[model samples]
Target: MNLFIGLLNMAIEKDNDRALYLVQKAEVLAEIELFYLLPHQRRWRSWFPEVIYCRVDVEKTRIYIKEAIKKGKWNMDDWPEMKHKILKLLSIDDAIIDLAV
Candidate 1:
């Protein structure tokens, strides 16, 4: 969860480079299977797999992404493909429809 929080912080800071860096770091942590081994960190560890896969629910992911966007942590031009990937991961199209009501 610390990794997720770090990602969120990176996004909120509009630091795409930093965000990517943190993501990479988190990925490494996830891959090593050490993300769940910390004491008193079971809650986050339980969700480690989903975080690695970016398979978290759209609503939750959206909050972080939206926050990042709002804070200017990401720039479309700098990460065009990544932007789309993030949107797709969060099912932005479906979120749009859901918000249309």
Candidate 2:
């Protein structure tokens, strides 16, 4: 609870109104995540603390990465490698194991 409050305070300080309001909502969710969910049973495992908790389908995650790369104007050919890194960040158990490094 304290951690969530502190995080909310920091977010509110640094972000704009919309982001601040979202952080307030996130704080409520964080409270539930921290107290209601047990350690092993928690979904997503706090994999990306900077990311808000939500249902992120693997395909959508891939698409988002591709879109972000395009937006950033980076010309990288390693689609497979980038996909693997995004999946790993999400802590998805089915992510390609051989790509681990």
Candidate 3:
């Protein structure tokens, strides 16, 4: 995650709030991913460290992702390949996968 934001920071103009905020959102989504995927993990030093212990509703998460995607002005084609694979592996619908990625 550090490397990703570091590269993005270096590639974009310095002190860019929009880019940084987008990265921050991405990091949160990543945390959400781990929260659902990992069953035995304890904690992570994030905004919500006790996410693993807290309830993680899959259907709610999916709806959350859908809502987020709808609200953002994101480039539809700029999704990472790993996102594609992850959503596909989880059996996400193709149309929703397009937005989630």
Candidate No. with top lDDT: 1
Q: Candidate 3, residues 9-96: lDDT per residue as tens digits?
A: 6655666655455666566566565765565443445544533333446786566556656676333466667556645654666676
Give candidate 1's error at residue 44 in angstroms.
29
Which residue pairs of candidate 2 clash?
none
Q: What TM-score should be assigned to candidate 3? A: 0.30
User: What lDDT does the true structure give each of the candidates?
Assistant: 0.62, 0.59, 0.57
In model 1, residue pairs whose N, Cα or C atoms come closer than 3 Å (at least 3 residues apart or on different chains), thus clashing, are 14-72, 14-73
Residue 15, model 2: Cα distance from true site in angstroms: 15
> Tens-digit lDDT track for model 1 on 11-44?
6567555546657767666654554465445446
The TM-score ranking, best first, is 1, 3, 2
Model 2, span 3-93: residue lDDT tens: 7768777777777555455758776777777888777655665542556745546787666555555465333345767756665786644
The model with the greater TM-score, 2 or 3, is 3
> What value does the lDDT take at residue 89 in candidate 2?
81
Indicate which candidate wins on TM-score: 1
**Given candidate 3, what's the lDDT at residue 85?**
65
Worst 10 residues of 1 by lDDT: 92-101
lDDT (Cα, 0-100) at 68 in candidate 3: 59
